[model samples]
Target: MTSPVPSVDLRLVDLLRHDLTAADFTVPGVEAVVGPTAAAALHREQDVPARRAVAAVLRAVADPAAVLTALWVLGEDVTRRQVDAALPGLGADGAVALGLVEASGQGADDAVRAAVDLRPYAAQDAVGEVTWWLASDLSELQTGRRLAADHVLGAGGASLTLAQVTMRDPRGRVLDLGTGCGIQALHAARHAGSVVATDISRRALAFAAFNAALDQPDAVTALDLREGSMLEPVTGERFDLVVSNPPFVITPRTGAAGGGASGLPDYEYRDGGRAGDDLVRDLVVGLGEVLEPGGVAQLLGNWEHRRGEPWTERVGSWLDAAGLDGWVVQREVLDPAEYAETWLRDGGSTSDRDPAVWADAYGAWLDDFASRDVEAVGFGIVTLRRPDPAAAPAGRVTLRRLEEHTGSVRQPLGAHLAAVLAAHDRLQGLDDDALAAQRLVVAPDVTEERYLTPGAADPNVVLLRQGDGLGRAVHASTSLAALTGASDGELTVGQITGAIAALFDVSATDLAAELLPAVRGLVTDGFLLLPQ
Candidate 1:
C-alpha cells in the first residue's frame, strides 16, 4: 500500500506557517472569508454553500483566505498564480516543496491541486486556547471517491471527543497511542513535559511529525515520534499519562489484511486489523503494563451488546483483567443495521455511491454481528487509572464505575473529570464519620424541581438536576432534598442530617449512614462541592 503523507522540513514548515499566519488562515479567518451559515454547513459534510461563498469572495477580490479555502478546504483546483498570491511568503514553490500542493501540468498557466487537506484548527482546553493548522490525507469529501486503505484522519468527532475528555494536569512523560496526525499529541504537549507519540502507520507518523513542526516549531523536538502498534513502541516504559484514540473500529476480517466487499479496506486510521471488539479489550488489558502507578489513561472505544448478556458485564470483564480503577461511560448505542450504515457511510461506501459493494459490505456487517450474538454496539469514553502501590488499598482495583448517559454534556470536560477524580480520591481517604463532619455546598449550576398534585402542599416528586457534567437528574428523596437545600456551607453534614432525622422521627446514626453514600455521590457528580 503506497500512501503519500506529508514530508517534514523544518525550514519549509516554518515558511509555510509564516505564510499561513500572514494570510490570516485561522478559525476566525476562515469564517470571515465564508459566512457563518456556509462555515457551519461544512460540519454536516455539505460543501456547496461554502464553495459558493468562497467563489463569491474570489469574484470580488483575491482574498488570501478565500483562495486558500477554495483550494485547501473545498478541494477545488486553482491556478498556480492564486496559490502564489495566497501564500506570498512561501508562495507556490514552497507549498509544492512541502508536498501540500502539486503542479497540475507543465504549462505556465497550469493549475495547482492540494495534495493534502490543510485547515485551521482552534480549541480551548485545560492548558489554554490553541489555534493551529492540521494536515491530513484528503478525505472522500475532497477526492469525491472512497477513502484509501491507509487514510490519515484529521480532527474528526472521535479525536475531538478524546481531546475534550482527557485530563490535562501537568505530567512528566506522556504517550499518544495510534496517534494519527498527532492531534492528541499536540494537545498533550501543552501540559506534558515530553510526549512520545506512536502509530502503526508510518504515514501517520509522517503526518504527525509534519503537523508538530508546523504548530510547535520550537517544541518540535519535544515530541518523539515512534512507529509501532499500540504499546509495542513503548515497551518496558512507564508514562505518567497515556492517551489514545486507537484503531478500535471492529471490522470483519475477510482476508489476511482485513480488506478488498464485505471487502472493506483496512483503514489504518480506524481498523486495527483484528477481530470484533477483541482489539479494544486487549488494549485495555495491556495498558497496565505501560502505565506508572497512579497514572491515568483515557480513550474512546466501542463495545458489543450481545444477546442474553449485559453490556456492563461485557466491559467490566475487561476492567477486572486490567486491575485498574476503570470508569466507562456508554454514550451511544446503535442497532446492528445502524452500526453497519454508519461505518459504511464513514468509509464512503454508501448505497447510493456503490449499491452492490454497499450491499455486500452491509450484509457482512450483519453476519459479523450475528456471529457473536451482538444485537447492538455501544460507544463511549473510557478512563483508567493504575492504583498506586503505596496506597492502603494497593492490591486490587478499588474503583469501578460503569454507567450510561446518552445525552448532552459539557465539552472541554477535562477540568470536570479532573475535579471528580480528586473528589473520589478525597472521599476514599475519608471514612463515613469524616465525610459527615465535612461541610458541603450545592453547585451553582444545580437546580431543584418539585412536582405536586393540584393545590397540594407536599410534592409528589422531587428531582435534583445537574446543569453540567452529564446533566444527571437524580430522584431526591424528601430527606435528600432537604439535605441539599440546607447545604449552604454553614452547617456540617452531620448537623443537617441530624436535624432532618429528628423532623422525620428517624434514628440520627441510621440517617447519617444512609445519606453519607449519597453525599459522596453528589460530590463526585458535581452536584455538591467541597469547600475550597
Candidate 2:
C-alpha cells in the first residue's frame, strides 16, 4: 500500500521563507550553549514538550512527500525522523529560548545548536546540522549527501587532494571525468577556458550542473555537463585536463550493487563492473587517447597486487602499456580480507544479513584474486601527463608513498612540478667542478643524511628525506656520498673536492675526477635541485 503522506510544519516553512543571513548568526556564548545542549537533547529519553510541539507541527503537513522534499531542500534527510523531533526546542539560545531559525538569527553559525549543557540528543542533532549546513549552499549538497549518507561533505579530503594534484596549466579545454557534484570541473574552470563534466548518472550530472551554478555561475557558460561513461559521452572531444574518481572497486557479479559485468546501473559511484579491478585498468588504458598532447590527467583509484608482480611494477606496467609519462604514488595497501570487508560494509551490506550471501560474495572476491594471482589491493592517486611527441619526452614513471595524512595549503606541489619539468633532460654529463659551480638547493622540508655499513670499507650511503609533504626518498646513493655530503651550500665542487681529498687522504686531482661524475649523477637523477 502507498502510505499516505504526512503533514509538515507551517512554522518551518515560514522560517524558511524568511531565511536568516550569515552575519546574523554570530551571537557570543550561543555557540557554547548550542554545542553541548543539542548533543544532550539528542540522547535524552524524555521527549520535551517543546520538541514534541515541533514534531506535531511537522506531522501536520498534508503531504509527507512534500515535507520530505522540503527537508531535503533544507539540507536534511527524511530518513532521520528522530532528528526532526528535536529541532525546535534545542538550539544555542538556551532551553526553550529559540528555535534554530531564531537562534541562527541571534548569531549562531549553525542552523541547530545545543540548548542545554551536555545534552546528548541536542548535541547529536547539532553535529548533524553542522554537517548539513556545510554543503547546504551547494546545490549538489543533497544529492552527494544522499548518495554517500553520513559521510562528511564540502570540499573535503578527497576533493581537495584532486584539486591540489590537478593539472593547473592553462589549457584549451578541461574535462572533469565522473564529475561528482561538478567539484573537479568547477575547480578546473578557473584555469581552463572551457570545461566539460561527464558522469554516468543523470542525477549526478544534474547535481554537477546545480553545484557549478552555485559555485561558479559565470563559469557556468563554459561548463558542460554530459551523462555517460569515462570518455563515451565526449568521444570525439579531446581535453587538456581530465580528472576522475571513477568506480574502481573490484567485486563479483552477484550480491553487489552496480558492479560486475551486468550491474552498471545499480551503483554509479564506484562500481566498475568486470571482476578483479578491470574498471581502473580500462580508465588508465583509455586515458592515453582521450588526453591531448602535453595534456595532464589525475585519478584516484584502487588496484590489486597479484602474487607474482609487485604493486609498483604492476601499476608501472599499465602506465608503460598506456605509453605515457606518469608519476604515481601508492599511498596505502591492504590485504584482500581486510580490503573486502571494508568495501563490503561501505556498500551498505551488513554482515548479519544473509550470511550465505555475504560469505558467497566474499568468497567470489577471494577467488577472483586467486585466479589473477593477486596478493593485496592498493589504494592511491595517479597523475599522468601525455607527452608531446614533438618534445620527445621519455615515458618516466615514479612510484612512492605519502607521509602526510591531511592536506596542507603550504605544500609545494607546484615547485615539485616545476623541478621535474626543469630537469626533464639527463643531468649526468656535468663535470664535478662544473656541477659544483651551479648553486643548488634542496626542496623545502628536505634534508640529506649519510649512513654507513658496520665493519665495512664501503663509503657512506647518501639518502634524502622530506620533513613533510610526501616525505619520501629523493634518492639513495653510496657512490655519491661525498658529493651529497659536500652539498653544505657553502663550497663549489672544486672547493669541496679539495677539502674531501685532504680529509679522506686522496689526491685532490683524483678526488675531483671521482666526485665530478658522482655530482653529475646526482644532477642527472632528481636528488639535487640545480639552479636555473
Candidate 3:
C-alpha cells in the first residue's frame, strides 16, 4: 500500500509554516548547517556527507533547522526531545498529526521517522525569485528502500528542466498536466492569469493541495487543482499554455515488473501504465485538442530510436499528426542496456542491494526492446505551438525544428525561446525583398571565430557562435561572414549584400539570393537580432 500524504489543515499548516520559518528551514538554512561540501554532495544524491555533517551540528547544540532537516530532509531518525527543541511552536505532536512524521518508539526519548519529505524549493521564473516549501513522499535516501508504485515525487532533475524551458510570457490561461506536487503550477501561477493543474494519482493531488495551501494560501482564485489522467479532466477546454513533465518512463509490461509478488517495481509516477513510449506519443498528438489556436505546449518525453529508422523521423511523425509548429531537442540517447540500468537504479533496485532482481529486470527491459528491434531511447524536450492562422497570412508550415544539443545551455530559456518565436513570425511575414530592406544587428551574446592553418594569412573556416539559448554554432561562408560583420544596424541587408557582391565580383541579385535565406536563419537563431 502507498503511504499517506500530508494533511492540509489550514490552522495546523499555518502553525507548521510558522515553526518552519522560525527555524529557518530553507535552502540556505540547510546549507549553513551541512556546509557547502555536504550540501553539494547531497544535491548529487550522496547523502552520507550531509548526514554526518548534520549529525555533527546536532551534537554541538540544539538547532531546530538542523533537527528538521535531519528528520525530514535527510530522513534520519531524530529523538522526540530533539524534535521538541527544534519545533517549540508546533511541537513533535503537531508534526505527527500533520502526517509529517511518525513515532518509531514509545517514550519521549524514542526516535521518530519522517512519514513525508518536506523541503524548501527556491527558483527564478517569470514573476521573479520565489521560495516556498514542498511536501512529497520520501525518497530512497531517506527510506533506505525502494519506491512504492503510487509514490508522489518531489522536485527532481526533469522537473527543473521543464521549468527552465517553459516560456514565461504572461498568459491568459495555463494548464499544467500531470502536475506532481504542483511544482510547475506554482511557477505558472506567477505569470498566468489562471492556472489549472491536474494529475491521475490521488496521493499526488493530496500532496499538491497541501503544498498549495502552504505556499499559496492567498492564490485561491488564481490556482485550481483537479484530479484525472492527462487531458481527461479538462476535456473541451482550451488553454493558452500547457506544460507537462508527464509519466513518460517506458516500463516493461510483462514478466518481472508486470504484477504482484514479482519483487519488481511498477512506479505509478514515472510509468503511465502504457506499453513502450506510446504514452508520450499520445500526448504529442493529443495536446493540440486542449490548446487554443495560438497556444503553446511544453513537455519532456522519451521516444524510441528503432533500428533502420532515424529518431527524428519517429518523433517527427507525431508532430506531423499534431499539425502544429514544433521543436524537439534530443538531449541524450541511451542504448537499451544503459536505459535499463539508469531506471533500475532510480527505483532503488541497486546492484549492491539485490543483484539477482536487478539482473532479471535488466534482462526484461532488453527482451522488451528486442521484441520491437529498438536500438536506443532518445530523451528530449518538446516545445509545440498550435498554428495561429492569422499570424501566417499566407498558408505556410512555420516551424518544424528537430535537432540535438547535448552541451551546456543558459538557464531560464523562456525568454530566449520567446525571442526566437518572435523572429520566426517576423521573418515569415517578410518576403525576400522585404527582409533585405530591413537592417539587423548581431546580438550582444554572439561572437565570431575564425580558424586558420599555421603560416596562413586568411582563415580557412569562419564560425558564428551563440553563447546562450541553445548554445549553437554555425559555419559561415565567406560571403555570409562578410555580410554579418557589416551588420551594425547602420546598413540594410540589401546594402551589405550589394557591397559584398561588388567586392567579390559576383552579381548582387545572385548574391542576395544566396544570402537572404542565411540571413533570415541567423535572425531566427538570435545570432542576428532585429533592432528594438
Candidate 4:
C-alpha cells in the first residue's frame, strides 16, 4: 500500500525547515554538490550517475547536504547517524513524528528511509526569486513501480510552465484549481491578498496542505483549502485571478489499454476520469462564472483535433462558448500515435519492456481516437478574461485569438501578457483616424533584419523581430519598414505615413490604409508601444 502523506504539524515542520535551511538544500546547493553531469542525469530519471556522484561527494567529506540529497532526492537509504547529523534540529524521532521518514531499527546503526520525496525548488517571477522545499509522494525512482492513481506531484515541467506564465500582478483574491501539491497556490500567495486552493483528491489536498505549511506557513496558513472537483468547491465565489494546471491528459475510457484484463489506470494527478477532453472544455466554458469582472484565468489544457477540422476552429469554439475574451496559444500538436506513446510511457509502460502491454495500450488509445475521429491532439496555454461589463463593448467579446506559437517564449510573461491585454483594450477604443493621430515608438526589444541576396542593391526581405515576449517575427514590406524606422516617438503615425507615401510616390490615404492594420498588429503583439 502507498504510504500516507506527510503529517502537517506546525512546530515539527518548523524544525524540518530549520534543518533544510541550515543544510542549504536549495536548488543551487543541490546542483553544486551533484555537479552538472549528475544533475542532468537526475533530470532524465537516470539515478546511476547521480548516485555515483553523491557517493563520491560523501566519500571525500561527510557533508550533511550531500547526505540529504542522497537520501531525499536520490531516494537512497541513509544511516541513522547521517539523518541525525543532517537534521539535527528535527532528529530521527522528529522526522518520524512528522511522517517524513521511517526508522527501521534503534540507535545509530538503524537505516532511515524517506517516505516522501522532498527537494528544493527555486523560481523567479515578476516579484522576485524564491526558494522552497517541496515534499510529495516518492516517484517511480523510489518505489520502482508505476505511481498510484492518487499520487500528488511535485514541481514538474508543467508546474514550472504554469508558474512562469502566470500573471503575478497583485490581486484581491486568487483561486488555484486542481492545486496539486499547491505549487501554484504558493506562487499565487506571493501576490494575492488571499488564495483558495481546491482539488478533487483528498490525498492531493493533504500533500498540498503539508507543502504549504512546510514552506510558507504564515502566508499559506490562511490559504483556503477545499475538497471538490474543479469549480464545485468555489461555487458562487469570485476571484481576480484563477490559475489551474488541471488533469487534462486524454485517456482511453476502458481497460483495453491493460489488455482488457486491467484497463487504463486513471491517475488522479493527470486524468479527470472524464470522456475525451470534456473536462478541459467544461473548465474553459464554466470557469468564467467565478471570475469577477475583468478577472483573468490562466490554465494549461489539451484538446482533441478531429479530421478535416482545424485545431483553431475546435479551440475557438470553446472561446466562443465561453463568452469571455481569450487567447489560446497552441504550443504543440501530436498525431494520434505519438500522443498515445508519450502518455503510455508517462504511465511507466514501455514497448521495449513489455511489448504485450504496450501493444494493448497503444491499440486502445488508437481505438479511442478513431471513435471520435481524432486525427491529432493539441496542447497549449490558455488565458481567459471576463470582460468588465461596463468597460467591454456592448454585446460583444472582442478578444478571441487562437494562434499557434510552438517556438520559444520569454519567461515570466506576466508583464508582457498584461501589457498585451491593455494594448488590445486601447486599440479597440481607437478608430483609424484616432489611431493615426497617436504617436508610436518601436519597442526597445525589437530589431529589424534585412535579408538581401548577394550583391543586391537593396534588401528584398525585411523582418521585424522581437527579442522578448512571444519572440514574434513579422515580415515587413519596404514601406512598412520605412514607417517603423521613422517612428521614434517624435512624430504621429499619420505624419510618418505621409512621409513614407511621399517617398514612395503613393497616396497618403492608401498608405495609411495599408499600414494602419499592420501598425495595430505590431502594437497588439508588443512590437510597438504608444508613447507615454
Highest lDDT model number: 4
lDDT of 3: 0.88
- Model 4's lDDT to the true fold? 0.89
Lowest summed lDDT over 10 consecutive residues: which window, candidate 4? 255-264
Estimate the Cα RMSD of every predicted model relative to the unseen true structure: 1.8, 10.5, 1.8, 1.5
Instruction: Using TM-score, rank the candidates from best to worst.
Output: 4, 1, 3, 2
What is the TM-score of candidate 1? Answer: 0.96
lDDT per model vs. reference = 0.89, 0.53, 0.88, 0.89
Tell me the TM-score of each prediction against the true structure. Answer: 0.96, 0.65, 0.96, 0.97
lDDT by residue for model 3 (1-532), tens: 5688888788888888888899999999999999999999988999999989988988898888899899889988899998888888778888888899999766789998899999998876545678899999998888777788889999998998888889998899999999999999988888889999999988898898888888988774578888898899999999999999999988888978544355466787898988899999999999999988889999999999999999999999999998889999999999999998899888877724777777788888999899889999999999999988788644345899999888888877878888899998888778998999889998889888999999999899999999989899999999999988888999999999999999999999999989999998999999998877
What is the per-residue lDDT of model 1 for residues 42-72, given as tens digits with 9 covering 90 to 100? 9889899999999899999989999899988
TM-score of 2: 0.65
Q: What does candidate 2's lDDT look like per residue over 62-160, in tens digits?
A: 233222222432233232232233232322232223222112343333343221111000111100111111111222322222223212123434665
Question: What is the per-residue lDDT of model 4 for residues 1-532, given as tens digits with 9 covering 90 to 100?
Answer: 5678888989999999999999999888998899988898888877888888889999998788899998889888888999999999999899988888889987797899999999999987767788999989898877787777778888898898889888888899999999989999999999999999999989888988999998898886669999998999998999999999999999988766632565456788898878889999999999889999899999999999998888888888988899999999989999999999888887777523767778888989999999999999999999999998777856368899999999999888778888899899899889999999998899999999999999999998999999988899999999988888888899999999998899889999998999999999999999889865
